[model samples]
Target: MEAIAYERATNIADAVKAAREPGTAFIGGGTNLLDLMKGGIAHPLKLVDITHLRDDGLDAVRALPDGGIRIGALMRNSDAANHTLVRERYPLLTQALLAGASAQLRNMATIGGNLMQRTRCPYFYDTAFAACNKRAPGSGCAARDGYQRLHAILGASEHCIAVNPSDMSVALAALDANVQVVGPDGARQIPIGEFHRLPGDRPDVDTTLRPGELITGVDLPPSRLADRAYYLKIRDRASYAFALVSVAAALQVQGDKVAAARIALGGVAHKPWRASIAENVLIGRTLDDETLREAAAAQMRDARPQHGNRFKVALAERGIVRAVNVAAGREPAGVTGAPA
Candidate 1:
């Protein structure tokens, strides 16, 4: 392990100021960053501890005046999932959070850390491998032809095929949440859809955050899909496994037809993929099996699955159809897909 320095930040300003220096990283729960550091993937000279900024309300989950909710960045995943407002209003987010990691990890992982978690591609984690574009830009992606079972099937570039490993982010994308950040230029809000980036040419850049920017909180707008929402995760096992294909589905139904729909996918792309095509198809249609299949197919029509993960195409389609059916109350919530 490398020698490192640590500083406890008193407030957001203090944290941001310390982070402005080169080779400085802000630490909250240190769930993912510590692992990256141990694996030699991330090497920060100084760690700015921001978990003590509760006086700034960076650990609170408060309801917004605009009929929305703002979750402090430092809020623990377990606490956020069990918060009364979150459980009552944004059940999908709660379900997604619970579906991730183990209970102990969720207890220690913060909302900000969860949003910033890196990919689980073996090629990226193991430095012995010399061909990981995400780790060493310009190097070829080893996972392109090696152990691609967990690789991406959508929105992938030749430089990288790893997938974003955040279940909370998938739910947030479906809810149209916004990320609040503070940097050298002051605070600004970024839409969740635009916050995470696809692996274009520059596969190293995962998010749109500026250098030294600190995520303060996440804002979720008012939504009517609370009663009709479902978060479906399909993994290799029943617990403590990363998703193979996950779907967050929320629908607004009027009488027998769908009034509005929101769908987002995880474990299939570099970022949480918003299924706009599927949403558009379901907006004015009834929740029939044929309609659900059509929506799922439309969502995956352009998917470019790799050889090892071709099963993901069918799995994703089935997962989406099942998620939407549960969200629309057309089917019961239960496990229904084969393991990927």
Candidate 2:
């Protein structure tokens, strides 16, 4: 570990100001950032402690006047998963939060930290390899031709094929949540679909957040799909493993037909992939096996798989079909690992 400076911020303004300095980072739960620092993947000269900024409602979960929910960025993952509003109105998010990491991690991880978590690609974590574009821009992407079973199959550039590893983020994309952030310039809300960035030429940038911008909370709009939502994660083991493929599926059904659909995929892209193509194929259609298959096919139509991750294309397709089937009530929802 490298020598570092620490500052405890009493307010959001102070935190933002402190973070404006070069090589400064905000710490909420320090779940991911601490690990990266220990591994020498992240080397910040100074750390701004934002976990103590609770007077700004940064650690509370409250209801919006529009019947939506606002989740505080500093709220622990386990707390958010079991919150009354989250469990009753946004079960998809609850399921996603529970499906990630473990009970211990969920208790310590914050919502904002989860959103900022880096890709779990081995090339990025192991500094010895020296070919990860995300780790060192303009270098190269070793995963492009190296071990890639856990890599991306969508929206990948030649420079990088790493996938976002957060299951909660995939659910947020499906739920159409908005991230509330504040910085030196003031505050703004970034749509969940646009929060994370694709591994374009700039693979080093993980999100669209501006410099010194601090994520304060997330707003989830009201939706009728709460009762008909599901999160499915496929991994090498049942627990404590990163996903090979994960799907967050929610459907609004009218009578026997689909009125609307929200589907997001994880472990397949640099960002949480919103399956708009699949949603377009399912609207107004019956939830039949053939329809599910068609939706899955449409979703995977543009997938570009790497050498070692070609299996992910088919795996993602099946995962989508199964997830949508469960969400549409066409099939029973099976157990998805142990809850955090």
Candidate 3:
């Protein structure tokens, strides 16, 4: 590990000031940051410990007057997932959180840190490989022609095909939440759907956040559309595994027809992918397998899969249809993959 200066921030202002300096980053649970440091992926000259800023209500999940909720960035993932208000109002969010890392990791991982988690692409992690565009811009993307079973099929550029690995982000995208950030220029709110950027020419930049900005909390609008929501995760293992393909399905149904819907996919792109094409096709349609399959297929119509990961395109399509059906209560639980 590199020698670094550590400063424990007294408050939010102090943390913000420290982060404004070059080569400095704010630390929350240290779950992701520490791993990056140990792996030599991040070499910050100074570390601003912001975990003590919880006194400013950065660790609370409180209800807003508009029937929404504001979740502090420092709130642990486990706490936020199990909070009475979250579990009751946004069960999909809770299920998404619980589907992530183990209980111990969830207890130590903060909501903000979870959002900032790095990609799990093998080329990005292994220093031996010198062709990871995300790790070193302009180098090249090894996954483009190398082993890419878990790479993206949507919003991928020639420079990179890495996928975001956060289940929480998938749920947030489907919920249409907002991220609140405090910086030198005061504060600003970024829509959750637009928070992450695609791996265009510049795959190095993960989010739209400007330098020296700190995320204070996440704001969720009223849960009217999420009453019948579901998060379906399919992976190599049953538990403690990164998603091979996951779907977040929320619907506002009128009898057997869909009034409105929101769907997002994980483990398929540089960011949590909002399936707008699928949502648009399902509006006013009956909640049936045929309709669901059509919407799912439409969403994957433009998928560009690689040699080894072509199965992901099919898995994603089937996952989307099954997830939407389950959310609409038209299908039972424990169904996996497409019909034979």
TM-score of each: 0.98, 0.98, 0.97
Candidate 2 structure, TM-score to reference: 0.98
Clashing pairs in 2: none
Which runs in model 3 stand beyond 4 Å of their true positions? Answer: 335-340
Off by over 4 Å in 2: 338-340
User: For model 2, what is the alpha-carbon lDDT of residue 99?
Assistant: 92
Window of ten residues with lowest summed lDDT in model 2: 331-340
Residue clash pairs of candidate 1? none
lDDT of each: 0.92, 0.92, 0.89
Stretches of model 1 off by over 4 angstroms after superposition = 335-340
Candidate 1 lDDT at 266 equals 94
lDDT of 2: 0.92
